[model samples]
Target: MNSKSHVPFIRTVKISERSGKDTIKIRIAAFVLALTAGGLFILFLGYNPLELYGTIISGAFRSKMAFQATIRFMIPLLMSSLGVALAFKMRFWNIGAEGQIIVGAVCASYFALFHDNWPHFLLLIVMFAAGAIGGGLWGLIPAYFKSKYDTNETLFTLMLNYIALHIITYLRDGPWKDPGSSGFPKIARFTSNAQLDKVLGVHFGWIIALILLVLVFIYLKYTKHGYEISVVGESKSTAKYAGMNVKKIILRTMVISGGICGITGMIQAAGSDMTLASSVAGGVGFTAIIVSWLAYLNPFGILLVSFLFSVLEKGSSVMQSTYGLSTYFASVLQGIILFFILGCEFFIRYKFVLTKKGGK
Candidate 1:
């Protein structure tokens, strides 16, 4: 007599032909599931999930002031995401937006502190240009190393962030320290000429951010340089075979990327902070990475995601004030929501199949 055995086997399969409708449906499902999970967490904390959700919505849009605040929060995040999207489109993994932003702020502040006698518009322009140059140079360092030595850009860029941060510390405690402050280490505030004027109720950074959105969209979708970046991102060998100068492309793209992020730093210092500080970046550089990925590296998508994230952040603050919840709790809620939405991408691209096997 022969013995037979049966077993179940599982295999992962890629879904290469998903439609737009299917993708939307999966995302919707993931969002609903995330809400459910977050609701349960709220329940466990002895809170009404529905009420909390409503609070979040109203808090972000309840008044003109609230709306303005949300826009303010969105400005740097939107700008930084746009910068990161450009580099990511080229598959460069430029994680040094934080460093780039810091250096830009430092450069902008130099003009703000010393060149206050210039006309207001001229001063602002000079600061902007200085910031762009500063950030571009800072970003170019990693790109040069990567092109020459094939170094790991991710780590290089990340390490640069710490160095840039320490630069601010050195300035505040050393050369740039305010002599007027009594025993406190801080930089001097910018003069009126260096400050950004308001358009509605908020600073004009929002207007700049919108302009950048259109520019980046057109740049990525229509221009030759954008096309070259896409080719390089797909395959360097193919790019080289197509007669494209891959090294030049890498260097130029990073300059643009870092320049945009530098503008973010300039805006933060001049438009909001009115002074450069270590907190000027405020993790906006890191948060922009999440926004860039969530938006699929599309400039328009980045705008939408950045707005949504701004709302989440502003609303979370309100939730904390209203419910007396700890900041960590709000962060956990945000993390839970993000995890579900991000995890859904895996399902959109792949699926599992089970098969039965028999042996004798």
Candidate 2:
């Protein structure tokens, strides 16, 4: 007992390589815990947590109109999350989805505004093509720099988002500004032919989202390029050692990522907004990141997460009106859920150990 009193117990955390099943269990548990915590917060606010949750579910699903609105919000989120998931699978941070979406919407609007007399189907095809090209090009920029010079893609892509926003702002305020508007800065609306029609109360994009989910799942699971992407994501050096074209893979992956986001933009313009605007993306680009991550980059899993997000978004209005909660409260709850889920990953990957001091 040399002058030091030995502590009876000491605890430390250590990493554990948990199995996939175990990880999934932890994540599910985390979700349940997060909801419980959120309910406590509601109770603290003097509201019945059960009623609030019931209202949220009913508000999002009680009627055809409410359900349709939820689907409407889910389309863009599903598409955007799919796009973000594609790049995330390759470990490339393509955060410029906002800019890509803006570029896409702008390109689609250009055609809609100038070629309104074109055949309806033809214009639709061309508009979609223009959006994909614009977004692909914007995504290509960051990839080119990263592949050629090892630039930081996170910042580059993020900065490009603002650049794309300003570009749309200029168009809305200047050349493309609607003269018919009462001096308000707004882009001209697309003609009826250029706009998308509803199918059973949902836009046709819902079909596209479903099809893409299947295709993405197959592509990732059964393709050579997909294998290459997995290898590169696991380790670039290993990919290079295996003779894979790492740079080409990165460039190609980003294009697909950005191109998908572009399609999402076109959907926004043609299916919903029917016009281009600086706020066209609606921050869905960032939200898509959360969706993609929460789904662990699983294409099918994105559908589930996207629907959950849509419920929160659509139900927020109900909360605001019925319970006098701030409209942003939904966002706050969503953030807390995400935080708890992510933090749970830490516990999933590690465990705490307690031992007597000075004991082996």
Candidate 3:
């Protein structure tokens, strides 16, 4: 034993870039693994996975009404996700979309509540503009700090969301409280003039969302600004070497991101709620981050992923009714899926290998 015995083997992990097809395969594998894991949990709870999955599919798509409801849910998610995608593309962590949405809706409500005397088209125009400006300004604040002082945008934007929520709460409980609702805290609903028209049971906001999708796709694919954003995202040093205005780019990108998010809030107010409230955004702003990442920040990919999430959201209610389970179970499933998706990236980028003790 003292005469130079050799060890068996050793292992080490190495990182490597994966091909496009391999990346897609890994993602698919992660998805399957997540579903399998979820099924195991369902089995442990004494529920039939096949039946539950079938119910989800049918609830989301079997009936015209069900499909329409899913579509309605998809609209805001799609728009908000696209908005988040814009900032994410440039490595900007804009976590304040929730707050930006609230600000936009609040600004738009100013017109709907008091300026109802204006022509319908004019009132709508004002609301849209107000929403965009309000959101853009909110987004610009974080960008300014990040550019000037290198502030942590994640915290700044996140804190802003709480502020926006408080603002809505104050407005609802104090100034904008509907006097007609007895003691209940409420904001006044918009008049018909301030509402969005529907075509075939879908609000015109769907049309706007679709148009923005195509525009965003084109902007990222073929525009010079999009290329500049790509360069900046890859490396600020490279962008600077290329003579790009980094600070201006940051501000401009955030404005676009926040403006789109604001429009989503306006659509929610005018097209769905027809009133402003703390829950007007309905958590779409936060959900949009998941949507954007799952879609790899591609506009068309966002649309597809948004639709899938909408199906889960719409179908989850049915699951609660049929299985007597909490609707939050759907959220749990989504979290599991995302967790696996993110975990799979590690395997895609790295692998462990075993070798002889003295092997290179």
Candidate 4:
């Protein structure tokens, strides 16, 4: 038998190089395809696709209040995505952002609950620090284990999320439960001084988020620490040969990553929720992981992606109300769009080749 007769008709080859413009073009095409596919789905449902799309857009930004709601949704997502991107850049899968956020909120809540009489600005600053420290410490745990024993960070971090949630349950049911809640399990709300003030009708967390964005961008692109992280991500062996302390970098970077996520918890509790709850994290940590990856770990890209995600989320509710669409239908549309966008990433890194019959 001739081996030549066994040749496959198609093969996938790695893309050795792709220009920025080409990559952008591919993504844009994917988005168009996604919209077309979603439009077909809407048409099948007895709705005008263009009108439905217009509703989605207007639902997110038709009025100042609507836009504010969208921004509210984006705030935590953008901050958490930025945090996750830092760990990802170092090739560390920090899946514990959810846990870190919870722990940070708990830590911040302690101050807000106990020190209500302190000066407002000073207290908020302190809560912010406490949250950052708590989150950083939580993140450092998995980093330490990974450095010393080479444990699986993903499972370790995931399990920690459950533990953190249970801790909140405990506090709500026992120690920190509001005494005046008449048998309902709940935590007390923060005082006015403990709450975050609004700037331009939105929580001041937006300001903090923007600041962190610039800082993270600078840290990732400019600093010596950033260079070390890049080297470690590419090849730990190479980093070691260059006299970089791999363990230290892992520990430090995780702390920073977790700390940023912790700030999200603080912002949510003080700026949005007005009290720490079991739902303080609100699954934003997990969603931020998708946002971070979708943006390819670029901070500015994260800002854009997070905003789009918020728009979809807010618009889905509007669709449910205005068009009588089921929540499931809205979800299906979102899934289709995400599917195409993510699918395009594959083509960016590789190409499919068709072989000629009887060719070597």
Best by lDDT: 4
lDDT tens digits, residue span 1-360, model 4: 976566678988898879999999999998899889989988988999999888888999999999999999899999999999999988999988999999999999999999989999999999999999999999999999999999999999889889999999999999999998886799999999999999999999999999999999999999999889889999999999999999999999999999998998999999999999999997888888888987889999999989988888788789889988875654565567678889998899999899877674
What is residue 112's positional error in candidate 1, in angstroms? Answer: 0.5
In candidate 3, clashing pairs total 0
lDDT of 2 by residue, 1-360 (tens): 676666547555667688889888999999998889999999999999989988888889989999999999899899989888888888899888888988888888899999989999999999989988888888999999999999999999999999999999899889898999885789888889899778998879898889878888887889998898888888999999999999999999898889888988999999988888677898999989988998989998899999999998888778778988886767677877889899998888677677854764
lDDT of each structure?
Answer: 0.90, 0.88, 0.89, 0.91
Weakest ten-residue segment in model 3 by summed lDDT: 3-12
Q: After best superposition, candidate 2 residue 275: deviation in angstroms?
A: 1.4
By TM-score, how accurate is candidate 2?
0.94
Clashing pairs in 3: none
- Count clashing residue pairs per candidate: 0, 0, 0, 0
Model 3 deviation from native, Cα RMSD in Å = 2.8
Off by over 4 Å in 2: 1-21
Per-residue lDDT, model 4, residue 210, is: 96
Q: How accurate is candidate 2 locally (lDDT)?
A: 0.88
- Screening candidate 2 with a backbone cut-off below 3 angstroms (N, C-alpha, C), the clashing residue pairs are none
Which lDDT tens digits does candidate 1 get at residues 197-283?
A: 999999999999999999999999999999999999999999999999999999999999999999999999999999998999978
Better of 1 and 2 by lDDT: 1
lDDT of 3 by residue, 13-46 (tens): 7676789899999999999999888889889999
Best-to-worst ranking by lDDT: 4, 1, 3, 2
Error in Å for residue 135 of model 3: 1.0
